[model samples]
Target: MAGLKPGAPAPQAITVHGQSRVLEIAFSDGAVFRIPFELMRVYSPSAEVKGHGPGQEVLQTGKREVGLLGLDPVGNYAVQPRFSDGHDSGIFSWDYLYHLGSQQARLWADYERRLAEAGVDRDAPMAAAGGGACGHHH
Candidate 1:
């Protein structure tokens, strides 16, 4: 299905389902989606995730346990979700959120496949684990 149409009703309520690590949004149209934190992180619209252009997307692994750190509204059109992984650049618009909800299954499958193709060991050290920290005092 297509993304949210122009003039479409925005979410009437939004809740961070921390226990389930999902963000639940009930749109004015009565459509609700439970988006997993992992999905939101990997699919972030930030430059860190999307990169400068095509083929520059950084593969996000080891984020199955990530959580939503916080959220801030952007005008009347979007919200920026700060992730536990220190990612807070993606400004998710209403249309983009709708797109994500509609494409969640396929996008998640692709993310999983890419992780496998990259041979990223899921048990690898997390970024917060001091992975490759130089520890330079400059």
Candidate 2:
């Protein structure tokens, strides 16, 4: 995966805290993060969320209470989460997870800004999918 960096710290432990809606991950380098499911859903690396290129991103909303239905490993490189809302295409590489964990605050701020610009409530229900590029990969 292009997102995986050389010598990146590998996860030592990964726990899904269903009650709190967070994915707690501990890295080999001793960095631990409790990433929220909502954030992961909103910032999913899948084409469904990121779209095909720049300026094509689909803003995600109403994910504040999103829950993880499952967490499946992707070989030795990443984890694919099955969200309660039926999103499961995102395969988050270790480096990407680390980035999310490390940059949570900045990402949240960005998401908030996007919502504000769209004049949408943070809890506004997402529009039905299939409005743009498909998430299918060849």
Question: Whose lDDT is greatest here?
Answer: 2
How well is each residue in 32-51 modelled by candidate 1, as lDDT tens digits?
Answer: 88888888888899867776
Overlapping backbone residue pairs in candidate 1 total 0
lDDT for each residue of candidate 2 in 62-120, tens digit (9 for 90 to 100): 99999999999998889999999999999998988999999999999999999999999
Off by over 4 Å in 1: 1-5, 126-138
Task: Show the colliding residue pairs in model 1.
Answer: none
State the C-alpha lDDT per candidate: 0.80, 0.91
Tell me, by TM-score, which candidate is best: 2
Regions of candidate 2 where Cα sits further than 4 Å from its true position:
2-4, 132-138
Worst 10 residues of 1 by lDDT: 129-138
